[model samples]
Target: MTLSNLNGVPGREDAVREYVQQQLGGLVDDLRVDALGNLIAFRAGRDAPNGKVKERVMLSAHMDEIGFLVRYIDERGFLRLQPLGGFDPRNLFARNVTVQTRGGTLPGVLTPGGRPIHISNPEDRSKVPELRAFFVDLGLDAAAVRQQVRVGDMVTLDQQARRMGDLVVGKALDDRASVFMQLEVLRQLTGPPRHDLYAVFSTQEEVGLRGAVTAAYSVQPTIGIGLDVTLAVDTPGVEADEAVTRMGEGIGIKVYDSSMISTRWLVDEFVDLAEQAGVAYQLEVLSQGGTDGAAIQGSRSGVPTLTLSLPTRYIHSVTEAVHVSDLEAGVALLLAYLK
Candidate 1:
């Protein structure tokens, strides 16, 4: 929940990195931040066979969420934005947002510049506004706004994580939930893993797999595992077949997505491990979307890679939700594989 609440957008991940670093104290043998702001932590293998080199395993979860930057501030104090990642315009209506400037954060309201429904024509009401039509209102005079805010300051949606029945609902859970799972796996380690682990809290994943691309090149892991959230569109309006994975059913073992297919052998291995350990898991095939696994798998001569996905609903929106049992199952499966 803390991880989800921290604000970090593409190319701006300091707050999230700092929090993760604090949580990792003494849990890892070595830790460092890369040039691209990816937080890399290493734990040496303890159970490697005598006279045999240990395999390097890379586990990555991104810290950045989809957000916007202050692109143009008008004379009247209305701030225009440049979006950083994919956003559904329908969800951007009248949202509470925070503008992080050099001095401090400012509260604001995000809405498209248009007439309200009461004053709007039928045609205007029927049309959804484009992303560029949106602006932030700070409720301050132009002079006051320009004195504080800048063109490149970060702007993020506001939402606090909360428990809803068996689910955890909050903003930025697309990957933060996976980040939490990775942290839990580290805390649960009683001894060194079977393989050398390189846990990477990556950045700029919402824009592209930018951080993972460089980190994978540096680590050059023999095996790669991406921690991310997958779609769980099991709502009333969606078809059953379109539901990639169902909430509370289990964690997802990725089989296919547009970015990269899971390495066949690695997928089989994880499935076998899950079955042996009695950990609930679902095989996922998403028609679109990608994760850090694609970047790692495509690095160098291509290391084998698979992504462990948490079932999530309403991804890319503030209400992104993940099932608690699914998160536990992910941690369990990871421990079984690494131990």
Candidate 2:
């Protein structure tokens, strides 16, 4: 429950920025909100590395989550949505939602148009609706909804973070879990860092890594570490080889994904450090996803970059799950590496 549950779309990350800043308090040497809504926190090291000028180390985690924005309100008070990030149409059905309006937040139910089981034919029962076919029912008159909600208002899944056994599940776990890791690391951190540390809660990462692209250019770090969630298809129906990572295994030292390949030396160094620190870890090669590391790797003249991924299941859905032991292992590895 300590994890932040605020709603943030790709381009709109103001609330998330504020929440991170509030959590940081006076722990950081400098904290600022960038033009692109990235929350950049600086922590200076005590001594330069090997007597040379210290290099900056960038640790990034995106704060944005997949959600929808209101595009139109029909005459019957049904809200049409434009997705802000990738979504599987099959998972979005009869979901409770919160519409963030200018006036106030409104409760609604997201339901795709389809025949009920009682009156449905065999084809209707088996049919799957497209993402565009879904509508939000606010149970209000069209005129009243129009007066309160604007076209660009955000809508997020209505769910609370919960603990089940050793696993935590809820909406927005994709990046918020990483955010919580950053927060816990900052809290337990004691002395100066080895390099100038910049913890960036980047925005618009779900859309196209927009915030990280700009933040990396501005920071021009010597090392970039992307902290995000990776696929954990350790459940039923998934092939053993296709399970990129397994839940509760440990932290994932990402080697390659769709966006970028990790710097080999850095990957090796992290593996060595994890062994030295006795932290549980796994090497991951995601087949089809990218993280902030790609943006940082492509930044001005490039930087040595890698990703530390937390294995997560059911990503981009309300029921995303992450293991507590894996989360702790990720924090332990990060702390060890920073030391």
Candidate 3:
């Protein structure tokens, strides 16, 4: 199986799911994709060296990324889009994008319709570009475009994963980076698990924790750990207090998000394990956005839920950045917890 790049870059989940299944092989005792298309991977405690029986543990990372969906094609052959996830209009203008159409993937650039900067006055510059004002140009005529693309086709920003100094940058790193960590944890995990383990790769996380809600109810694990990306506004931010985390620090032990408040014991356990394992970490309390942990926490009878996050910069944009050290820290903590 090849690598799956399901970072909402269009048609990524199928590849990711296939790669995971192949990697698990005989190790995965059970695997199933739900109606919502969440890939559930199961491995047992008995498979470990100690073979001690333990309750189920759920680990999840969202597979969805914020992107555009083709909604309308005007007579001029420009395609209008509807956002599949939250996006800042400021980031949309003059950005390159890839459109997945009926014919194939078409490369294009998204630009807002307005006067060029050279001709525009300062007042025009001050005007914020509404999302609806943007359109993608594929350099094709109307007939050609209509034949190649269709409404509801997927569109993703043209971004590539690359090493930027000590960090990785690309779109969808908000969760794709977390997904990579979860896979690494599964791969490098040598210790015996104490309980039935379910590693869930969920969908539609960008819009809300919708996929997680259903997946958690199905697994009903005693504990749930939502793997995600937290803030790293270490850049030239307006203020430092708002920066929830620091890049290269380590995994983030999330204290709060809009959707869920982490269980105290679970958060403490993560903290202790990180310390004992010599894993670098930071405490996070995000004032905005949430992850799958909330859905798992709201599951039947309420599961003790926590989140481990990789610190990220430029979230929901074309070039989300995450430090390698932070991802390593997440793996370290997760491995320690499994032990």
Candidate 4:
């Protein structure tokens, strides 16, 4: 839920990983990271029946989101940035942002690189700002700004989390919500899964699904489930057909996405379980965006894979919204799947 807090916190993924580790420390059998920097945690399965090598279950939630870095410092103490992820130009005016410097955090607002409004023309106003046209003002001189912020300083939006009834509204929830869900499942597991369970918190999903490629190769799970958030376009502007899913609905069973096509048999089994358990659920066919399952499914010999997603709204924005009830359903469905 610390989307704003995590923005611009690129490569500082270890900090988030450490936070998760501390949160689940005593409960997990082991907690560590793969060479590619994914947060890997192990919760041994209930004393493997007959002492067999337990089957593995890989769970992943991306810890990264779009953000920016300090690209240039201007004479007037303004800061230029290089975007780390896709950013919409329409939403880049006078918005508060965080300049995460090496020394300390400095708060600032983003505005286009331009002259005073007194001399600006109507056409200039019509021209929506470009990502390159924006600059962050940290309220400091050029030398002081340079001293505090480095070339690659992380910068995230300042829209802190807000409560929307039982739902949570914040940035980076695109997948952290799933990260929380995974831990909650482990908390409820009480024992190991039917097979070996490997909870893998992946990295660089927004960029290229990099962490999972290495992780899938290493873990080799027979079945992989990418736990993440999916678009729930229940709001205005989007037509019913254009919307991928809806709010307050159950977990999304990914049939296919740009990255991979989940096995037909596995998808059917998930639906069956959801129905039998009376858990609210729905089918999904994402137009784009992929999860860790894709990477794992193709790794090595090939493994059956699927995505278990929490229905989220305003994805990739400073405020990703998800109903609390839906999040709970996602956890329950995963538990049912594991059993």
Candidate 5:
């Protein structure tokens, strides 16, 4: 929940990184932040044959969330934004937001630049606004706004994560939940892993997997595992077939997505491991979207990769939810594999 609440957009992940670093202290043998702000932590493998080389396994979960940068501030103290990642405009209506400026954070309201429904024409009310039509109201005079806010300051939606029945709902869970799972796996390790682990808390994944691309190149892992959230559209409106994975059923072992197909052997291995360990698991095939796994898989000559996905609902929106049982299953499966 703390990971989800921390504000970190594509190129700005300092707060999230700092928090993760603090949690990871003494858990791993080595830790460093890369040039692109990806936090890499290394833990060596247990005893192996003197001449044998242990495989390097990279586990990546991004820290950044979809947000906006202050693009243009108008004379009336209204601020225009440039979105850093994918955002459904419908979710942007009258949202509480925070503008992180050089001096400090400012509270603001994010709304479209248009008339309210009471006075809007039927045609106007029927139309959905584009991202360009949105603006932030800082409730400050132009001079005061200009004195604090800048063109490139970060702006993030505000939402505190909370437990709802069997699910945890909040903003930024698309990948933060996975980040939390990775940290738990680290904490639960009873001994050195079977393979050398390079846990990467990546940045800029919401934009284009930018941080993972460079980190993968640097680490050059022999095997890669991406920890991310997958769509769980098992709501009332969506078809059963379209529900990529259902909440509380299990963690997803990715089989296919638009970015990259899971390495066949790795997928089979995890499946077998899950079955042997009696961990609930499901096969996922998403029609669209990608994760850091794609970047690591295609890194050099191509290392084998598979993603472990937590089924999530309402991704890219403030009310993103993940089942607690599913999170437990994911951690258990990863621990079983690493052991």
Candidate 6:
């Protein structure tokens, strides 16, 4: 919940780093913030053959989420924004948001530059606004807002994490759910890992897999696992075949995505591990989107990599949802493989 609240757009991940370090500082062998703002934590393995660590395994979950960056503040105290990542524009209508300023957080509402429905013609009422048409109303005078808010301040959706029966719903759960899963894996891991472990809370993935590329090159691990969220389009009006994953089914062992295909050997190894461990698992092949594993796999001379995704509904929106059981299964499978 704390992680999901932080404003971690592409270049704005300081709050996430601070929160991660504070929570995980004492648990790992070494913790450091890299030049690209990736938080790297190491845990030495004690179960190596010949008492020497043979392989280094990297685990990554991006900390950044889709957000808006303040661009132009008009004289009317309305704030214009440039998106830091993808937004549907349909979700930008009269939504509550928080602007992270140097002085303090300011509350605001996002509204598209359009006529009110009551005052609009039929043609105007049917037209959807473009991304550029959106602006934030801070409810303050132009001069007062200028004094407190600056250009490049990140604006994130105002939504609190909540449990809804079998699911958890919130904004920024696209990756923070995985971030929390990583932290839980760290806490619940019982014995020393078989390979030296590098758990990296990566930055700037919502923009592109930027931090993952840099961190993967620096670590140069033999194996990498990218933790992320995948579409769970199982709701009404969507066909079963079109649904990439079903919520509460199990952990997703990704086979392919638009970015990268899983290493065949690595996929086989994970399947074997899941079967042996008696963990519920699913084979995922996302036809459209990508994850940090693509960057990790393409780094240096290239490393074997795959992603484990949590099935999420309404991605890139304020009301994203994830099944608690599926989340736990993802953590369990990854933890077992790491062990």
lDDT of each: 0.96, 0.90, 0.83, 0.81, 0.96, 0.89
Candidate 3 TM-score versus the reference: 0.93
- Of candidate 5, the 10-residue stretch with the lowest lDDT total is 45-54
Backbone clash pairs for candidate 1 read none
Better model by lDDT: candidate 4 vs candidate 6 = 6
TM-score of 2: 0.97
| Each candidate: RMSD | 1.0, 1.2, 2.6, 2.3, 1.1, 1.4
Error of 6 at 97 (Å): 0.8
Tens-place lDDT per residue, model 3, 1-339, is 012134353223555566666766765668999988788988776453455447789999987778888999999899999887778898887898888876778989999998999999999999989999999999999999988998988888876677789988887787878878888888887645656789998878877788888899899898899998887898883488988899988889999999899999989888888888899989999998889999999899999999987899988887788898998889888888885
Off by over 4 Å in 4: 2-8, 47-54, 115-119
**Cα lDDT tens digits for candidate 5, 196-305:** 99999999999999999999999999999999999999999888999999999999999999998999999999999999999999999999999999999999999999
How many steric overlaps does candidate 2 have? 0
State the TM-score for model 5: 0.98
Per-residue error (Å), model 1, residue 225: 0.3
Predicted candidate 5, C-alpha RMSD: 1.1
Clashes of 5: 0
Give the lDDT of residue 97 in candidate 2: 94
The deviation in Å at residue 73 for candidate 2 is 1.1
C-alpha lDDT (0 to 100) for residue 222 of candidate 1: 99
User: Going through the candidates in order, what is the number of backbone clashes in each?
Assistant: 0, 0, 2, 5, 0, 0
For model 1 the local lDDT of residue 245 reads: 96
In candidate 3, the residue pairs with backbone N, CA or C atoms under 3 Å apart (3 or more residues apart, or in different chains) clash, namely 54-194, 54-195
What is the Cα-based TM-score of model 1? 0.99
Can you write out model 4's per-residue Cα lDDT over 11-91, one digit (the tens) per residue?
Answer: 656656766777787767888788878888877666566757566888888777777888988777788998876678776
Cα displacement (Å) at residue 227, model 6? 0.5
